[model samples]
Target: MQQGAEYSLDDHGADGTRLVLSGHLTLASIGPFDRAVKAIDGPIHAIDLAGVEEIDTVGAWVVCRAAHRLSSEITGASPEALRLLASVQDIDVDGPMRPPRPPVWERVPLAVGDKVFGARSGIYGVVAFFGQILIGAGSLIRHPRRFPIKALVHQMELVGVTALPIIGLMSFLIGIVIAQQGSVQLEQFGAESLTVNLVGRITLRELGVLMTAIMVAGRSGSAFAAQLGTMRLTEEIDAMRTIGISPVEVLVIPRIVAATFMMVLLGFYASLMAIIGGAVVGDLTLGIPFWTFLARIQEVVPEHDLWVGLIKAPVFGLIVALAGCYHGLQVRGNSEEVGRRTTMAVVSAIFAVIVLDAFFAVFFTEIGWG
Candidate 1:
């Protein structure tokens, strides 16, 4: 059976009123006890708890709150009850409800600095990863047995052959759009035939290699990061290291080699698809016919344009692979980190590719290959 609880107010001779508490002063008894306490008017001089049969933290808090409000003392509390009351006494029920936040303007400089630091750290990691991949490549050259040929073939199939459909479709569509737009502009000045020159040169010199790099970065680079990040999380990388195996040789080098070789092949394929698309668009819309379009492309789009685009493929591949593996190796703990690093890998690879392409454009132009 639960015990009953009560609080009684009695006027004292000199020291004001005494609050007499009795029975169970606990969670079960708090409702009636609290109501009885609240009914009393004026300040309480003292709290008499000797008649309290049982007490808990909740009961102690009630008594302490009443005493604090009335500015009175507590009498006849046992050691445990007294300790509970003492602990809750200093608690600031009237304290600030929420912490103050800094103004937006105050946070701008700090945010900028943090981003700068993160970019610097990422650059350093990528450079170190590139150097490590180089070392692994050299080791494979010296010790052919240590080369991961199967892994290389598998990655090539995944990163190159598997990605062909999407790369081809995207390039083809881009070519159609470029040709259509170029014809619209060129027709105004009676230069509709120049659409062939526009499509061929743009596709060969820039779009073919650049677009393929971006797509591969989004596809293969993210997969590389996710694969290695998962391995790191599961401690598989650690096991490899323990068994005297280098992760760079087994995991990193194969991916680097696959990406580097495949980019050239995929870029060439994209250029072909883009040219075909442009020819189809010209035949249908401009009535230029496929043979005429191809002949014009061959005549106008120089050999240097194709060479310039193809040469950038391997470098772009290396950037994507390095970014992906670098972030993957940086993964530390959980599935969340894996996802975060994968996204970082794709973003970093794409950014690096665009910046490098811009530099290559300036470089090729400076050498009179523009």
Candidate 2:
């Protein structure tokens, strides 16, 4: 039923139920629809949706309810009744469905470029790195008594002594392989006497120290980043600062200092094992007894070779420590951020170590020392 429309019901017609609405089917017209159905005097066995122009959920629901009651009164209702019910099935009472919008980049009001460096994250990273190192050193100097001796010992054990077996095995195996390869080429020229110098200089100046740095970067660097990143994500770094303690002092210095010393130890041990293993290979293939080869090493391997390896230790250590601490502190208080920073720390530290090794190689070569 609609405003300005007439409604009629034919109870005894061929259809047994005939209803008509002759105008627009709006919300305002449902009342007559309700009354006509209610006021009908016979069974209502069918309904029709053909006349509906645009019925809302409420209007649609009224038709459905009338049709249902009518069908119960009779044995079966026309499929028109079911069709009306089906048409409104997708309507939502919560609200009309709106398509989801994609996220848009809206400019934030604040100005980071003006406040910080205009366009220089690399320079900013360098400054922050040096600043954190100074803060760490000063904090240690100021509070020597409160330094984390227990944590230092624990970290030292983790990064140093516990890694000996794998380090020794790797260094020894590498020594054997390098000597075997060198023997094949040197045997052609009867220059196998050079094996001692080769093994000595290569192990001490490059392979030993370089490999040690990579191992430490992969081992200790990830640990430091993950530890501090967890703290950063939990706001424990903020808590330390709030309590008048710098996170660098409480977290970074111990790791940096420990890694510095451990790297030197690794370099020394890796060099020694490599030399010993190379000597074994020399005895087997070059007909040089172990002691004779050792004597040759003393004659040919210069003091500077050892010095180069030792000098690289602290640099590699600092790179690993700084990379780890930097990535850790960059964490933005999320578990995924902690994991990302830890992975970044390991990767960046290894890259820095290798890059610095290349620079060292160039420097030594320029000085006629390589």
Best by lDDT: 1
Question: Model 2 lDDT vs. the true structure?
Answer: 0.77
TM-scores of all models?
0.78, 0.67
Question: Which segments of model 1 are wrong by more than 4 Å?
Answer: 1-89, 97-109, 112-120
Residue runs of model 2 more than 4 Å from their true location after superposition = 1-119
Candidate 2 has what TM-score?
Answer: 0.67
Error of 1 at 280 (Å): 1.1
Please state every model's RMSD to the true fold in angstroms: 5.6, 12.8
> Taking the tens digit of each residue's C-alpha lDDT, what string does model 1 give over 202-319?
9999999999999999999999999999999999999999999999999998998999999999999999899999999999999998989998898999999999988999999999
Q: Which residue pairs in candidate 1 have backbone atoms (N, alpha carbon, C) closer than 3 angstroms, thus clashing? A: none
Question: What lDDT is reached at residue 217 by model 2?
Answer: 80
Model 1 RMSD to the real structure?
A: 5.6
lDDT (Cα, 0-100) at 20 in candidate 1 = 86
- lDDT, residue 308, model 2: 93
What's the CA error at residue 147 for candidate 2, in Å? 2.8
Q: Write the per-residue lDDT of candidate 2 for residues 1-370, one digit (tens) a residue.
A: 3353245554675767755433444467667667766776566655544454555555656655565655622222236544555776445434547866544432232355454564487568769878877977876788789788887787788888987888888899888888889888888998888888889999999999888888888888988888888888788889989998877766787888888888899888999889989999999888999989888888999999999999998899889988888888788847998888889889889888999999999998899877
